[model samples]
Target: MAEGQRALIVSAHPEPTSFQAALRAAAVEELAAQGFAVQVSDLCAMDFKATLGPEDFNDPRDTTRLNVSLEQRHAWQQGTLAPDVAIELDHLLAADLLLLMFPLWWFGPPAILKGWIDRVFVSGAVYGRTAVFEKGRLQGKRALLAVSTGAPSQSYGPHALNGDMNDILMPLHRGVLGFTGMTVLPPYVAYHVPYVGPAGRAALLSSWRHHLRALEHLPALPMPRLSDHPDALGAGERAH
Candidate 1:
């Protein structure tokens, strides 16, 4: 909402002409009009390597042995991470608002987006032992998920066949975004996307633009703070 703020949209739709792509493009235009410097990571266009393995590291101290986590930490320290990961990190660090735009697949993000998180949210760099939760490296940043679902909104309720949308997104909003100290905003979901008529799609895009216009005023979803609880695992059990 602030003038000259930087926004990064990580879009994972494979087809350029898809509805997801149209929403993403609309977001760019709207946000830019609101004085945002926008950048997009079109994952499919980039053909981003979704899997992490030994190849991610150029040189290993012990070539015969490999621990992915340890290797990631080492890479971060040495500034030797994969070039793509490094670029993404730079973009993330510079962003004030981060938008993850994708069509929900099996009640979650696409595999390509998941892999981007796995590789780019490096241990030592984005998070670490003491720099997590309330003290995370990305504490001041905001993240919102702009998601699309093939099913109708009615099917996503608590008792619906598709289960609750909020429950399905908890792992991402709480475990991932909140864990990293981002202010997780309530998601914007467009349901029954494929079945929607042209008018419905246009309305959804209009809603998205309105949402962006008031982004700074939107309340962040509540998240538990690590500091609010005791360090001991069974503290609550002991109290009870």
Candidate 2:
């Protein structure tokens, strides 16, 4: 919470005038007010390439073998990662807290954000054999997902039609962020966004502002210990 601490918000909405964009804007303002040096990566605005291919690496070990993870790791070690990936990695490494803002598309993040993770989170640079989960490369950093959903909050639960929101988010929270050694915060969701009126939207924005202001006191979602899952380690496991 120190003055000038950095916060990076990765916004994945395609429309500049969308509600997701407004939420991203609100986050930037609130974090700035709280003395954070905010940086935003508006994926759509940047026209960020979401696909990972040979172009992302400078030199491939075997031109015939197209292994993304291997190439990404090699690129990092050789300081030859694609410019975009390198830049994003720099932002992530410098930030104290990283927020991913996007609309929940079919129970997951937009392809742009997913692509960001695929390219920027290089295997050797970010995580490796022993550098994951509790001992991940970015161990001390924090991450949060601020998402919007079309369904009402009541529609999400163990038995509900949309299923549990927390369960739906476990992939990003535990598999992605936790695997990278970040403390994952509970998601801030703006549900039934299309149905909410101005006042409701305003209320949600207000709550978002409050959340950022009190980030230091917010409890991180509990993740299983490395020892808890010796079989698969940080791989697929049931949400706790």
Candidate 3:
């Protein structure tokens, strides 16, 4: 492991027997092999809370005092979050490369992970003129989505019911993580959960290792600074 570089792997699966844990172990091993420090937060094991409250905003528990600020209120569209989210807020601030490992529950993150986002990706920490991602506080930082899906990849197509897996997780990519300033790399989705046996799991982790190796030499995502904020350019001059 390196002296300062650390990767935080946050897993949100309830069952330790799950292949999700295997995926996490694979990522940790791969990162460690590259001499990167690794930290795992088995959120379910930690008994993570899944609700939000008023104190989360540093205000009294008015039950309706979500108005921490305009930005906070703006995010109320996601609903109120629990106060314990402060703990996650701290962890996120310290991590460099964050790996979110979870199962795709009903086409999205588990309720617990969503709550973590709700609480930790708070108004002040995640938004403002000067934010972690607002102006690139963590511009060089990276995030990867290691998700497990019960449905097959074909089922996630345009005509299928699952919808585009990438689109389904846009909240993590473009909304919370990217909006705060992190560069989201291509997600690693393990589809067809039912067919994932021990051998299949091994193959998945092997592929995961290959992906990690491919990224080992690259320090971070390749997005340009100005490109980080598409809205930064003039309305008429900004190109797609």
Please report, as a residue range, the 10-residue window in candidate 3 with the lowest summed lDDT: 74-83
Candidate 2 local Cα displacement, residue 120, angstroms: 0.9
| Residue 207 lDDT in candidate 3 | 84
Clashing pairs for model 1 are none
Worst 10 residues of 2 by lDDT: 231-240
Question: Quick one: RMSD of model 3?
Answer: 6.3
TM-score, one value per model: 0.93, 0.94, 0.78
Write one digit per residue (lDDT tens) for candidate 1, span 3-41: 878999999999999999999999999889888899999
lDDT of 3 by residue, 50-105 (tens): 76655454433344544454435444334433435655665677887889999999
In order, candidate lDDTs are 0.88, 0.88, 0.72
Runs with alpha carbons beyond 4 Å of true place in candidate 2: 230-240
TM-score of 3: 0.78
TM-score: which is higher, 2 or 3? 2
Per-residue C-alpha lDDT of model 2 across residues 22-109, encoded as one tens digit per residue: 8999998888888889999999999999999887766777687777777887888888888999999999989989999999998999
Compute the lDDT of residue 43 as modeled in candidate 1: 97
